[model samples]
Target: MQPVQAPVLGPQVDYRSLVVVLLSPLAFALVFASWTIFAVLGVELKRVLLFGEVQFAVLLAMPMLTGALAALPMALLARRVGGRRVMIGSLLLICPLLWAIAYSDVYLEFLLAGAGLGLGAGSLAAGLVYVASLCPRRHAGLALGLYGAGMLGAGLTYFLLPLVSQAYGWPMAPKLFLLPVLLVALLLWIFAEDAPRMPHAPLDSLAEPDGARSESPSWYWLPPPAVCRLALYYSFFYGAFVALALWLPGYLAAQYALPLKQAALWALAFTLPVGIGQIVGGALADRRDFRDLRWWVSACVMVCLFLLSYPDFTMQIHGVHGDIALRFSMPLGGFTALLAVMGMAMGIGKGSLMCLLYRDHGDDMARSGGLALALGGLFAAVLPLMFVLGNEWIGIRTAGFMFLYAALAVCMLLMLWDGARTRSSPLTRHSSQPPSQAD
Candidate 1:
């Protein structure tokens, strides 16, 4: 028999060699901002269109829901048409959708426009795949971090869009926004290079069976166990993070009775910590193993759960009907510390998860990334419904939800530890070694 050989890794890529890497990040940034347009614009849209809270929330979440479902399909589309073509098509599609949203006079029209929002955000799955394919294995972590910076683009919409809305009004905001997205797409067309496809396990070929194929019968295209682990982790990570992003503003306003402006400021504080954490987390993941990461993330979740459970102790923002006698002396400091911890954990966990997937999946990053994203989005849908139902039926609040979810996280972590241990055991035979061939 011919000797088995490891597939060759892509050549080491310099910063200059990977221009499309920048496009993925840029694409992600735009999608992040667009995905959040509802949160920023929902109130205005409600007033302009005379819609209810339920209606508004649906509109706000429709893009996210659709984007979640669209990721796999988008990945498939990218495979069929090419990432560059799909990305540009998605971006151009968004311009008309923005105009439709801007000019929409009815709820149905706005909802239709919301579908367009999903289309734009769906591009992220494809972009993640594209960027991962371009980077050398060693640099995937850094590339994910840079791609994560696109998440900060939401902050831009929150801060700048409001200012722009004040000056130009709500309808005009989307119209003006189109110019920048179009410009970025134009830049990407000129500067972004195509990703180089690498040889994969023949089992991994997404293409339908043609008459002939690669000759390597020994090769397999299965996703690495590490990638599956990352996907599982992301279901909890993004679910919790994005749920908080969607839920916190409402929680602050209703539970704490803060003025809208103050609540918005508080929400900003909450989000800012996550972005900071992302940077710190990405750096740590580059160095730390998943074993250490488990402890760190668990600890962060526990602390945040504690803080969230005790609003009176943590913030005292809620009005106390019975007694003003109770006080947590260092409430603000303690709350800030916990939030920072949670943010750092999320940041690190998010980047590490992507990095691990890339290490395992390598050139098949799109399929793996799409799976990760879809699972996370799936959790995002389920978790919120559970939260709402728990609130309605059992009178559980956000803190209660946090405590419950955090417990689930602990259990999942244990499961992962056990799984990892089993996978690392010597009992599993290597491809080259027979069961009776142990040395």
Candidate 2:
């Protein structure tokens, strides 16, 4: 790779770039909030429709599945047309869909309209490209983190839906988003630029001969292997985050028998920390290599997962004196605390991993970011079903935690192997330098 260089800046550049960074993630947060609308709404939909558990689960997963599939293509479109345009287009696309969802009473109609929320995945990809291009190397992690913290938008739905539905009814809940979505889309159009030459290959690579660069369209869109490695790390953390965000309201409701609105409120414990921790992780990533921090974050999450994986059980012992019985169950307070810690750890993992992505793979930001988001979406989609099946097949409520623990173990082992391989490499040595010194 060509040596990193400092970007030339004008007085106006900083102000403009600042606008892009601030404005873009606001757009992202709104998109993200809208993306998971079904999470809160599904509870009511179930009662009204009288749908089975599996059908409810499918309805929950459909947007994530479609979003995962759409992320890459939308990212590719962003690459050609521009991040600003795609993000604006994505925001606009969501408005009609929200209307469709609010008006629909049928299960099939609501399900399909809900699927349109996947456009937010595209919003994420394109917005990341626009924001990362303007961030200086010294503050890339912090910039990315701030952008990521927009995920707090999910909380808007969590906190808002209960009040909206309670007052106006469930159908009016989705309609509430229509004005804000349009407002954000309009702001993006007025303030955000296309970032004409965002992240792409080095100047040297751009100078390659036409003959040398010739390749199939399929080959051209593929991200490099190094990027895929980073995506693997991100997918697990982000996927779990998304899955739990969707699953938790329901999980809390069923496991504790809490009312749906109350359960949604409680789940803010997990979702809020995840957003805050991303800012923490991204700032740290900007200052140093993330490998060591990644290990610590993973270890913390694993410990929590280990605790969470245990199901309620009773034990009996036969003794000469008498019979002894022991019983154990997870307390709601303790479970919420564990969820908060794990969410923070996962958020840190996500923040740092994304920083690392921009650090190394910004040159192909669209494809690489798309690939990671897509994988995360697929993982999120699979997890709800797994939660359902695990409960049925294994007859353990904590089975979802068990599955996550296993997946995280595999990720950690792979990271360790990769770390050992890179330890002695020149690139690793160079990357260890401080951003200012390295540049």
Candidate 3:
């Protein structure tokens, strides 16, 4: 067979590449919608199965754990074979698994089927690599930002799944997901083109002369410290975003005594901003210093978490004549407004973090982005358990916000420490870029 030709990189925009970039996010949205179906269904399942708080948390977390574990291998496969093929195959494979989930009668059966459906989440790893290959280096931030908007599918599920379940039945929810998954997969198969692969080279030998590195980095290169930092930030921002997406419908219903449909709508107060903020954040990262942007975003999130950390409190005062009582609590509208702001902050952080990852590891984005996402997903998985434990131990619904507050506090402290250290260095003063950029 003849060798595959290199992709032409012209000065003008490549409309073919742009089309692929646009389509990749739409495909991702469908897969993501399917992957997160459990979030909406879990609330109903809790009632049907008579599951306790911890068990419900486990049920919610299972798919995230499985999805995180699958990310690295799926990304490597995308790199080796082709992103388009991996994406199409993943979408096709998850359809039957979703059907199985819909048909599952026992809790154990549902858990097993949900694990299989988790593969749908791995589409992000492949989609990232696929979109990155099509866009120029300068545009990678915007491209990834646009692709990241596929997360809006999580919001879409929040809006639509409850309605679907109400209209058809809980079992029919996953079955509805089947239609879009197949449609997106077929469109991708017909229209999407995989990026051309470069010849094999030693991992360390691919470094650029000025140390900027090419678009395709080696798979075996050790991740820099920045990767871990970004992962932590992402875990709090993107991971927490995922956790809340799963948690919020139930949260609103329990906390405010809202109907399921109303609760889902309230959840959108958080989810919609996160989706739109990513696009705005991506555009900002392209023009501004990502380091500065990330710091500001983290600071804002820290404050929001602080406000959100408060649980309902009541105090009674004894007077000469009688007794007086006072209560302090955030109203639902106030709480939702805080979540909206927090979502925007997370969205900006998500966009900036991806930009940093692509800038530093563009060549190996499949691995690096996948690993980052995996780590973030792990946090998403664990936090739900923490939320349950916090609630059970503390006997307060808002206990989860305390956990988030602590996490964001740690992130803020680390950022400040890193910032102070960087400021003291003369070289860092000259260029505020990450040490990996020096490579």
Candidate 4:
């Protein structure tokens, strides 16, 4: 059997690469923090607007909708003009909208402001493209993972916004975020540099041999099949992460009957682990094959989701003379622990998926990453509405977990089928290619 070759690390590291890695995540964190401002603020908005469950869900979903819509366009523009331009332009455009959200007195106004704020979320695709351009190929996974760890910004919002709102009112939270947004914008303008351009083949030409030519298809066409599959994978891992980050505060308040502040704290417990786990996941992907890492993580998360899907259950048994009662429910502490475990697994899966994309589509990272993020964000936007509908229609508070569990089960089955097909292929016997390459 042929041994797998180790990834080649470039002989020298670029200091500019270090700068991009350090600042990009920090900038992304600030953008994410602003993008997710609605999660915490929506609680206050619900009270102010006197909105019903569905209405509030829509309110929380508005930014995600806009983010999803903008992701692909922003990514394409970044690829053409430069990531720095896209990132800076996006940050600048959202600042006014955030300020408007702070002062919005009515529901429509807040919705409009939120739609504008959605542009902030598009920064993820731009940041991914930008960081990939700067870093060495061997280190792309770790670099993207570190940048992705900026998701901790959501945790920061969960932890800090409630406290600030308590002191200065919820309106002040958006205003406070403006400071960081502006600061990051200035830093990016001063320090950020566009990476040297790498030559790329058309996505359609990827299957052809070296020096082969194919028709250059229209730029606006649908993504390739591999991109769609990766997007589906991302929709479950990162998309679910986005949905839960926004939904958890409300879910905790409703399900566990906790106050807003306490609910935010509990939600933070889940968000922090997911954010930190990305780094570990990325590092693992750099050293090992991402396919194996993703499969193991997905399997573990499926178990946790299965366990979490059960609503508080109670049973009555009739005995010879008397009645016996049985009750089964996960306590709050235990539920939070399970969520933490799931978050860790998701964090790893997110990193591994990004690594896999870079490895397979290195030439078209911008377009592929952008489309994947757009689909994931679209899924994130839709899940909140589903959560509200599930609760109302089924009368089960844990319905959201049930939905997630079913989706993950389907994803796992597809992975298994793909694995089987690979092993059965004639190429598998003769080629020493990595499992990821075979896929």
Candidate 5:
């Protein structure tokens, strides 16, 4: 049996929803940029505060910590009252935090402000649910891809903040976001549409793909907790992409001896590709099931990580002529290429996985998207600290990549086992096949 498609909607609805989807990324991008504020701004702050690597990691991750904590509740709230209200309120909520960060000098003050950036995460949760609710199935991947591309806004600070900080000063940088955030919030308040909430129902993965016009069901309707499975898989791609996006400028500068702005620019090789790949992933996902696609995405990411994890090495050998020394390291170009490819793979995986989530849980995106983002946020929060710890314990600058490699390998293995077990189950076969074919 084929998957069910979304019911056809009138052209007016189609046009309105498309408009909402097109503009939705602005809101998502604003929240995402806010969520990742520390990535670039912290470079200057780190210099002023004279914090240790560990403390810097903490500062870098604090927003993610709070964001993860906030995602689910915001999602639940959106479910009851509708995503539009939650999203609008969430967008407006970050204004004070930005103002506070601009004025504060203390690390605690900054951290407290950073914690409020969790509202940015909640906004993302609301925004994702909103888009999922309105987007039709035929273009589901593209819709999610556009929403995911809001991560590109993280690059806005990466590219522009340093310039803003250089001229007006670091304090002035956060203020730049104030206008755009307000504008997006206002637009969403006026124009966004959310799927009407239905009576609470059990998890149903077999729900129709067209989310907005469908008889949308309640949260996590899939049996055996498919939402959790989707969340877990997406967490790796999203978590790693976000962690690296936040951590890479620092790593590039430290490892390559580049200036801060220069390093941030180079890190865009990673982030820009990740953003664009979301579109690619979404487009591809529209054509087929993404379970198989994710295997390729995961495998590509692993291969890239395997290469990236190897540190620069110097080798010596005694020869008849004389002692010979050979030095090997990833050149800037090679490293950037690999990073871009890895980012692409991660982006594609994220886009496809989100689409998969919608295919299974589109009717329940408020809960599903919230849980997924929450897990990704928590996972992202842990990665930088792990990178710091891995370096201290292992004494390799590339230790972060190594840790990611190992983590991915473990997940792949576990998923492989799970897939094998599921395939072997008679009940799984019976449930998967249509009634006409089950016999």
Candidate 6:
């Protein structure tokens, strides 16, 4: 008698899952919108708390360090407890913390609130892993890109939060923010599904039925090298962005000798473009038409460096502050152009690496995403320290330290080039495909 063939359950190919996948990032993004509140709020808090410069920087950076350390564990927890559970729980947990920050009287109490927010923000890593596991093989890039827009939520907050805080007061500003969080949390709690289990069937028969585990899937996890490079790249990429996010206003204030509000408004021009660039880069990644991401990313980096190198660019305007006349000159155009290019590079590079990693190592996304957060967090944590050290040693009169940041980006590109050359094997190539209808 001829041997019978086993049946395949086939892949769960659908676009509707994309919407579900996106919610995690969207929720996480909103949480991260509050992540930098400590940094933003610290400006006012420090005045009341009377912290030293180093202490202020510490408060600004510790949340990132805490969040980074928390990511891997959160990923593992999500897998065990269910992604929807952890995600919804995180949103709920953040509500009290945001409200607490508004009312805290003591500095230590406020810092503790910031730390609590960091713990809540760990949802981002879990969300990334959750989204990665949701989509079928083919649309992973586009799916991840849409989800990744959560990172841009910070830019939105930076531009808008101050205005809100000014109008409603800091205490009430977060209350308004929490409204959206509550709404998103409710939706995710009700709608998000747990990861589906592979159906089981009898194993004794030679001819296995459909949905049986007669054969193992061919998917592999992210490799050690790719993980290392990704960490390195994200470390620099996120570090640069974080450093800018924290210090740009201060830099502009000193450079132009502008008042606090004017400096912040000018910095908004620099940071807001980041969101636009990220969206544009995501659109590019979704198409997958841009094969050599390195070339485009490198070009953007070079343009950014060139624009940032020009020290004489001016952005001066007159403003009245309570009947006192003021004149300020900001490097608005130069800084904005540089930030936009960096944002574009970060978006393109991050999405490309994620697409490539998932394509090659779908099974390893949990680990890869964890590692990305770890290193990225470490970089973000250390960046404030770098700014302090750079200013202390060399002064902000030059771009020397900024070049160190640029060099790190260049090194990441080199590593990617090396990986492309050495690791592009036949099996890897074959497996690194988007899902097919037949998969």
How do all models score by TM-score? Answer: 0.80, 0.91, 0.89, 0.91, 0.90, 0.77
lDDT of 3 by residue, 1-439 (tens): 2223222231224866776778889887887777677777888888887878888888788878888888877877788788889888989988998889878878888788877877866677888877776777666677788898898888778888888899999988888888888888888888777777744432335465665756354445346676667666676787888888889888889888998888888988887888788878877777765877887888788788888888889999998889999999889999999999999988988988887777666666766788887887898899889889877887878878888888878877888887788679887555545543432
Alpha-carbon deviation at 330 in model 4, angstroms:
2.6
Please report the candidate that would top lDDT against the real structure. 2
- lDDT scores in order: 0.64, 0.83, 0.79, 0.81, 0.82, 0.64
For candidate 5, write residues 272-336 as lDDT tens digits. 99999998999888888778888899999999999999899999999999999999899989999
**RMSD value for candidate 1:** 5.8
Candidate 6, residues 404-437, lDDT tens digits: the string is: 4466667756867866875577654555453441
How do the residues 305-330 of candidate 1 rate in per-residue lDDT, one tens digit apiece? 76666544433344567434456433
Give the TM-score (vs. native) of candidate 2.
Answer: 0.91
- In model 2, the worst 10-residue window by lDDT is 4-13
Tens digit per residue, CA lDDT, model 2, 246-289: 88888899899998889998999998999999999999987887
The regions of model 6 sitting more than 4 angstroms off are 1-16, 197-223, 259-262, 268-273, 276-291, 306-330, 397-410, 413-439
Q: Point out the higher-scoring one by TM-score: 5 or 6.
A: 5
Report the C-alpha lDDT of model 4 over 244-313, residue by residue, as the tens digit.
Answer: 8988998888788998889988987788888778888888888877787777899889899888888998
Candidate 3, residue 127: the lDDT equals 85
Error of 4 at 252 (Å): 1.0
Candidate 4 clashes between residue pairs 3 or more apart in a chain or in different chains: none
* Total colliding residue pairs, candidate 6: 3
lDDT of 4 at 419: 75
